[model samples]
Each structure stands twice: as C-alpha cells, then as structure tokens.
Target chain A: MKVVYLDNNATTQVAPEVLEAILPYFHDFYGNPSSMHAFGGQIGAHIRTAREQVASLLGAHPDEIIFTSCGTESDNAAIRSALYADPEKRHIVTSRVEHPAVRALCAQLSGQGYRITELAVDKDGRLDMEQYEQSLTPDTVLASLMWANNETGVIFPVEKAAAIAREKGILFHTDAVQAAGKIPIDMGKNTIDMLSISGHKLHAPKGIAALYVRKGTKFSPVMVGGHQERGRRGGTENTPSIIGLGKACELARQNLSQENTQVKKLRDRLETALLNAIPKSRINGDTEHRLPNTTNISFEFVEGEGILLMLDLYGICASSGSACTSGSLQPSHVLRAMGVPFTMAHGSIRFSLSIYNTDEDVDMVIEKLPPIIERLRSMSPYWTGDK
Target chain B: MWEYTDKVREHFLNPRNVGEVENPDGVAEVGSIACGDALKLTFALDENQRIKDIKFKTFGCASAIASSSALTEMVKGMTLEEAQKVTNQDIAAYLGGLPQEKMHCSVMGKEALEKAIENCLGVTETSADETAGHIICECFGVTDQDIERAIQENRLSTVEEITNYTKAGGGCGSCREAIRGIIDKIQFEMTPQTAAKAKLSNIQKIKMIEETLEREIRPSLKLDGGDIELIDVDGNRVMVATRGTCATCKAADITLKHFVEKRLRDLVSPDLVVEEVTQ
Candidate 1:
C-alpha cells in the first residue's frame, strides 16, 4: 500500500541528505569528540560545525546551542534550569495546552510546592493574552509556553509573551518542538530566554535535539556528570544523530519557504475538502493563527479511534485527540482545555503535513476520508443523520 | 496504536449487525456521547423466546464497535437466560481479548445486553432503581455499584483496573478515593473472616454498616411491609431512611435505634449509632 503519510507533527521521515551526512560518523569516524588522540579530537571540529549549523537555524550564537537527547530533555533542562537558578521564586506560569513534556513536568513541580498558573485557552485553542499577562507575578521564576500546540497546531504568540515576561523580569522559555522547523524563528528579534527544538520533527533522526539558551542566562545543569555541553548538560554526545540533525537543520532552513507555501496549500486543501465533503465536522483550532502544515478536524458522533483505524486501512496516517487513542477515558487535555464540546472532542483528528507532502497525497486523503467518516457515522448510535 | 487481534480488526472493519430490528422485543442504550462512547442494542425474539435477531449501533472506538458487533453474533440463537450468562469476558474472548485500557468496551456490550434483557422482561424500572447507587465518578456517570461490579467481574485489584473496566477513575480523578473505598470494601468482603479480626478502616466500617443494613435490618423491615435505605455513614453515625410503610410508622425511631443500631453494633462495630432521617 502507498502510505500517504500526513502525521508529521508526531515525527518525520529522515531526509536522505541527513542520512548521507551521518553515515561516515558511525563506522569510519567512530571516535569520541572528547578523546585526546587526533583521530577522535578531529571529530570535535565536526561537532562544532554541527552546533554552528543548528545555531544558524535558530539565529543564536553557536556557543548557546546545547545538543541534548530529545525534546523532552531540552524542555526539562530549560524549565528546571530556570527554577534552580531562582530558588526563592516558587511560582511558574504556563498554558494548559502544553505537550506532555512540559505539562507533565510542570505538574510534578506543582506537587513539589511550586505554584503553577496554567493559563486557559479560548474555544479556538488560542491563549488569552490578558490572562497570560496577569499570570506573570513577581514571584514567578519562569514562564514556559509552547510555540505551537502538537495536537491542534495553534501557534502561540511566544515572542510577544516573552516580551511581557521580560518586563516582569521572569525567565521565558518556549518549547518549539512543533514550530521550529516549520516556521522561521530569529532569536535576535525576540526577548525569549530559551527555546527547545526536536530533530525528529524536522526530517532528522530521533534521539537528537537542541536547546538554544540566550547568552548570559543563569543556567543550572540537569545532568551532573562530565563537563560536556560546557557543564550545562552531561553525558557523551549522540555523535551521528547530532551530525544528522545539523544536516536536517540546514535542509529545514532551505525548505522553510516551501513549508510555508507548498505544505500550507496541501494542508488547506485537505482541510477545505474534508470539511466540505463531511457534515457535522469543524476545525478544532484557530485556523488563521495555527501552523501552516497542520489542521485538526473533529467529526462529531463517531469516535476518533474508529476513524483512525478506518484511515489506516487505506494507508493514510493521522492522529487523534480521542480518549480511546490515549488510553484515557477523557478526550485530550488540549481539546478539553479549549472547551471543545465532548461530542466533537471525542472524534478530533489531526492531519499534520510536511514539505515532502504533495497534492496527490492531499487528494488521496480527500478521496478516502469522507467515506470512512460516513461509514463510522452510520454505525454511530448518536449519529441520527439529521445534521 | 492498540495491538488489536486480527479478529477485532475483522469485526471492526465488517461489523456483523449494524442497525435496529423492526418492532424489536428488547432494546437498550448504554454509555453516553459525553463519555466518548455509547451503544444502542435491539433484539427480536423467536418462538422459543430466543434472540432470533440482534443488532447494535455504537459510537465509540474500534474495540467498542467490534465488541458490540461480536456480541450480537454471539447471542443470536440463545435464549434470554443463556444470553444473560454471556459475560464481557466472553465478548473480549470472542475478539481474542481487548487491550486492558479498552476493556470498558466489552463491559459496555455486557451492560447493553443486561439492560436489553430487562427491557424485554418489563422490569427495567425496578432494576434501574436498585442499581441507582450513589454516583461515584461524576465525570463518567459511573455509580458505586457499577465500579464494584466491574471490580468483582474482572478480578480487578487496583483503581487503574477499575477505570479500565468501567471508566470510573479515568476523568478528573476526584472519585479515585471513592473507587479505592469500594475496592477496599469488596476486598474485605472477599476475605470476610480475616478482615473481621483486623481493626476496620473508615471505609470498611461504612461497608459493614451497609452490609448489616441490607442483610440484617432490611429483610426484617420488609417482613413487616416496610423497607430501609442506607443514606450516609459518617464516622460512627449511620443515617438511614425507613421506606414504604416504615416511613410513616410511629415506631420508626424505635426500630432505627433498637433493631438497626443494635444489629449494626453487634455485627459490624461496638460503637455504632443509627439515626432515621424522614424523607
């Protein structure tokens, strides 16, 4: 079956260029970057170049880019570093619709006596700027928000929010896991203190991510071992994946415009066609303010897992915010936080596109998805075919 | 993705019975749209009072639809009594076992069958009143009885398992303590003699008060054309309501303090007080 891969926000296909760039690092150049021998020490130069490449993508100094295992680690390091840097401040400000990486960590912090002000979102999954501004207090050590939501693809005004946090003298971090590669970001233009980027979200292999810390930010190390990553992070580097990530970042920078134009068109096409063809369906996020490559649509009455399984039969990949899909009896926290009606929230499907997606892929999804929805709705007890 | 067996995939892809039967003898609806799953089942009876035809309409996940489909196929030619014997485990086994988290789907099939049978027998109202225990999980509309039954049927040992089977603690989780209380009570009952020797927790005490009311006091009250309902158990104070003739009887307070309190103190704990609340 031809896989019409649309679930790019979850992960992306590793680019051939990235694979080629990392091949030699595995076998012939299998030497630690920290070794004293020249054969291994020369690998450090490549690592520097990789760091510079990643830094260039984020518009940060090469010294500010710290390579970590993945997005979760980057998020953890950034949030914990802020808290550890300011022990007197016991309050943290964040949004309710964050990815589990940040959301779960904040929850744990709350259990440990840190006051967390989880700002609520509007019905369209857009955060209220006034509520956000009010959430930042003098005692708030950090305000960690996501640049874009993984489930709904709603892009937050992180740069604007960061400026507000800056006025309050609070550290601001953004988990750009879903936003980094798809959108253009320049650290030089924003007051953001730190940002996290995952490689797998950008056609790079998994197990590689970068944390961009602004210069002169008070940092505390999460992993305390080797003096690697200038003591900001520990452990030996994932050499080949890091190199691959560098290549992927270069490709992402080159393809950024294509992502905004070509991928956005495919996403809009799929969204428009599906909504037109299917009744009792609506988009789940703020469409105008969302990522260019993603759309979340809810097919009411039918469950999301049923729709996903039917789509799987046709070799079309997507994801859902349904309770059954996540093994929790409630729909996704993101959807629930947005105040989406439970009827629609139960059947929310997210279709995230990438630069590799084509018009044919969009067309294939449009052709296969409506019938699947019709079939599920037909079987649904609540679907009376009235709407 | 869930590791659904080929059988589950088969039934989900091509569900056996997809719609309602015309002028069906038995019909039932379980779950709700807000709960993220619901099922409507209908059946027609044959000459032998067997289920001649059965159909289901489910708004849920793959496992839920497959379970409903598999259920109608399983109970086709069976009598209502035999069909009543069909457990959620049977439906799950029919699909080579559902994922533990998705076990509630099979439970929904079983509940729909039970309710449909009650609808056929014309005793749904009585059964509904009996099963209308206090709502423990407000998010899922799961009653205490529902959680207890799921625990007993599935041999569930933890609150997480109860959620898997009945969706009791799968939402805001405010009812987790209530679910834990139910589990403790059932576990205590499973090993009653052993639990009796140990110092009772507050939940165990509440369970004992309920058990004593149902077993010792209610039957005696019913013998006199009256009934009783356990209202609340707060510490040593047990609040109950005399129902039917007992509610208006002049000796209701005497019966509460003398018979009910005395029986509870003897059977459950030494320091027990029963107070009758007029409804």
Candidate 2:
C-alpha cells in the first residue's frame, strides 16, 4: 500500500535533490574539512559553499550561520548563549505554545533562579502583544518564541516581537523549524537576533540544523570542546547531513512560491472537505495567518487514537494532540493555553502536508476520513446526532 | 505510540455492546470528559437477577473503549455478586493486557462496573468515598482511599506508577509528597521506614509524648530559662503548657510553633502537630 504521508511537521521525506547533492561526501570526499592536506582542502571549499547555501535561504551571511545537530540543539545553544552573554539579567520571556525545546529549557532555567514570564495566546492561537510588552522588563535577558506553532500552524508576529525586544536592548530568538521552509523568512528584514532551523522539518535528513545569529551579536558557546564553526560550536561536524541540509535549504528557497500556492490550496481543500463531511469538525488555528501546508481539525465526540487507528488501516499518516496519543492525561498544552474546550482538545488531529503530497492524496484522505469519524461516533456512547 | 496488544486492537476495532440498555435495571457513570476519559455503563438483569444485557458508552482512548467493551462481555451471564468481584486486573486480563500507562482505562471499567452493581442492589453506600477521607489529588479528584486501593491492588511502587495506574499525581503534582508518604506508610507496616515514626496506640502515644518532653524538650527549655510540660496528646496534636519564662515570652506563639513544634516533628512522627493549651 502506498502511504499518504501528511505528518510533515513531525518529519519530512528527504528530497531526491538533497540526497544527490550530499552523496559524494560519504565516499570520495570523506576527508575532514579541518585537515591541512589537499584532500581536506577540497572538502573545506564544499563546507563553505554549503554554509553560503544555507545562509542564502535565510538571507543571512555565511558567517552568521552555525550548524548544530538539530532544531532542539540549535534552540538549546541559542537560549543558553543569550543567558551567558548577559549574566546579570536573570529574567526570560516566552510563549505558552512553545515547542518542548524552548519550553523545557526555560523551565529548567527557572529552577536555577531565572524568572520566566510565559505570554499567553488567545483562542485562535494569536499572541497578545499587550501582555508581551508588559513582560519585557529591564531584568529580562532574552525572549524566545517560535515563529509558527508546531501543533497549530498559527504564525506569530515575530518581526514585531523582535523589534519590541530590541527597544529594551534584550536578545530575541525564534524556533523557526515549522516556518522556515513553508513561509517567507528574510533575516535581513527582521530584527530577531537569532533563529533556529531544523533539517528534517524541511526535506533534509535528520541530525543537522542551523542557528542563524545576527552578525556581531554577543557570543557564547553551548558546546565547548574543539574549535569548530569559529569556536561558536564544538565537536566534529556531521559532514553528510550538513551538505544535505544546505541542499534542502536551497530547494526550500526556490520552492517557497509553489508551497504557498499549490500546497496551500490542497490544505484548504482538505480542511473544507473534512469540515463539510464531518459535523462538529473545525480548524484549530487562525486560518489566515498560518503556515501554508498545515491544518489541525478536531472531530468532536470521537477519541483521537480511535480516529488515528482507523485512518492507519488505509495507509494514511497523521498525528493527534490527544492525551492518550502523548501518553499523558491531558491534551496538547498549546490547545489548552488557547482555552480550547476539553471536548475538542482531546480529539484534535494535525495533518501537516509537504511538497511531495499530491491532490490525489488529499482526495484519498477526504474520502476515507469522514467514514472513520462516523464509525467512531457510532460507537461512542456520549455522541448524539444533534451536536 | 503505546504498544497496544493485538487483543486490544481487535476489541477496539470491533467493540461489542456499544449502546445503552433501554430500561436498564442498573446505570452508573464513572469519570468525566474533562479528565479525558469517561464511561456510562447500563445493565439489564434477567428474572434470575443475572446480567442478561450489558452495554457501555465510553469517551476515551482505545484502551478505555476496549476495556469497557471487554467488561460488558465478561459480566453478561454472571450474577451481580460475581460481577461485583471483577477487578481492574480482570478487565485488563480479559483483553490480553493493557500497557502499564493505560492501566487506568481498565480501572475505570471496574469502577463503573462496581457502581452499576451498587445501583442494581440499591446500595447507595459509597463507604470509602461517602465517609469522605481527605482528597489527596484535587487535579483528578482522587481520594486517599482511591490511592490506597490502587497501590494494594496493582502493587504500585513509584509516584509515577501511581499516576499511570490511578492518575493521583498526574496533574499539577502538588499532591506528590502526600502520595509518596502514603506509599511509604503503606509499604511499611509500622512506619519502620522512619525511626521517628511508629504506629502508636493511644496509651503508647501518651507515654511517648511524656518521654519525648522529658528527654528532648525540657532540657533545651531549661537551658533557655524556659520549660515545657506535656498536657495532652490527642490524635497528632501534642497540646502542651509552657512553664516559667516560656509562659511570659513575647514570641510564645513562635516558640510553640517553630521551637517546640519543629523539635517534636523532627524527633517524633513527622505527622505530629503541636499546640499550646490554656493552663
């Protein structure tokens, strides 16, 4: 059975172009980029080209891009480095809807005497700017927020938020793992001091990501062993994955228009069809200001796992924000923070698409999903037809 | 996810008795939609008082639905007496077995079954809960007796296991310390876990209180130009009358709470609460 892959926010299938671009690094050019010999000298040029390629996608300089293991590592390095640069300011601010990468780190920092003010989101997952402005005090060192939420596709006003932090002489960073490929991100136009990017969220293989640090930002290193990436990062570079990531970013920059047009249409169509076919199903985020390739819908009166298991029978891939799906007793914290009802939150399903998806895949999903919802609702004891 | 058993998958895919009995002799609902899982159980009894028809409505994960479905099938021909004996383990065992974290789904099944049986027998006596012991976990509305029963039935060891099995410390987790203490006390018969703690009878409590005042408190009080006398020992509170300088101290309340209470709490059972009595 052909698998209809839609859980792209979780991870994406590696593009053929990216694979072909990095294939030579594994065999013929296996020499370390740091060595003095010609064999390594040739590899050094490739690394520089890859760095430039990655920087080009973000509209940043090659010097500003520091490759790390993945988005979580990039987020870790950026937040910790910002705190290190300003030792006196012990307050940090972020949003309630942050990915666990930033949320967990800020929580750990809070235990070490650093105060955290988590800004809340409105019902549609939009951040409140008034509360955000109030949270920025003289003691705040940095504000880490995500450009777009992973669960809901709602895009935050990061550029405006960055300018807010800038007025206070505080650092600003965004985990752009979900937004970098799916939307237009010009680092040259934004005041964000740092931004994190992941490889697998785009069409690159996992284990490679980059942190874009604005030139001349106060610097520190999260990993401190060897002199790699100009001592901003340490340990050996994952050479093949770096090459793959560079290629993936180049492709993402090229396909940004297509993603906005073609992929967005498919997502909208799927959302519309699901909503029309299945009653009490509604989208979870602000539809106008969201990523182009994502939709999270809740099918009320049916459990998420039951819906997912039934979807799996037809080789359809998706994800859920249900408590049972996550092995915890509560649904997604992002949904809860938005004050989504307990009835809707537990049945929320996220279907994140990618460039590889076709209209046929969308059609297949629209055809197969409504019946699954109907089936689960039929078995549900609480469900009545009126709702 | 969760590594669900093949039997669990089968039962969830083709659930049995997925509706309510029209005129059920017994009906009960357990859990709530807010906590993410709930079950509404209804059963009809034959003229022989055996369960002739049983059905369920559940809004939960696969394990919860599967467990409910399995519970109905197991009790179809059994009398109310036999069905009342059904444990959470029996529900899990009926469907091969559930993941350890998903064990609460089976627990919900058993609770709903027990309540339904109570409804059938007209037994409104919720003895464990109606007597209303202190609620340990307010997040899930778990009572002290609920935690104790879960531990006793499932042999739960850690606070995490208690959350997975009973959802006691799963939310907010402010009750973790209370749950941990309960687990320790229940794990050890006479509070052998702590030398300061013991299962003292009323006479032993009085003797220990006098001995504690004579040994640990009076000597320290005498050194400070003050003294303490044990007046009464009722439950955990040790009512005491301060003598000499302690009686006229400006910070007498602080002396009773911080100095006296702290010392007694550290030396005797940690559950002890100290108070000053009127002379």
Give DockQ for candidates 1 onward, in order.
0.63, 0.49
lDDT of 1 by residue, B1-279 (tens): 799999999999999999999999999999999998999999999999999999999999999999999999999999999999999999999999999889999999999999999999998577687757989999999998888888778767677778889999899999899898998788668655543554789998888777767655675688689999988888888888778888889998888788788767766776778887766
What are the TM-scores, per candidate, against the unseen true structure?
Answer: 0.87, 0.86
Tell me the lDDT of model 2 at B207. Answer: 80
Clashing pairs in 1: none
Candidate 2 - chain A - TM? 0.99
**Per-candidate clashes, comma-separated:** 0, 0
Error of 1 at A130 (Å): 1.3
Best model number under DockQ: 1
Which consecutive 10 residues in model 1 chain A have the weakest lDDT in total? A378-387
lDDT of 1 by residue, A1-387 (tens): 999899999999999999999999989898998999999988999989899889889988999999999999999999999999999999999999999999999999999999999999999988899989988888999999999999999999999999999998999999999998889999999999999999999999999999999999998889888988998888998889999999999999999999888989888889999999999999998988889999999998889999899888889999999999987788999999999999999999999999888889899989989999999988988888855
Which runs of model 1 end up more than 4 angstroms from their true locations? B193-279
Q: Output the lDDT of residue A150, model 1.
A: 95
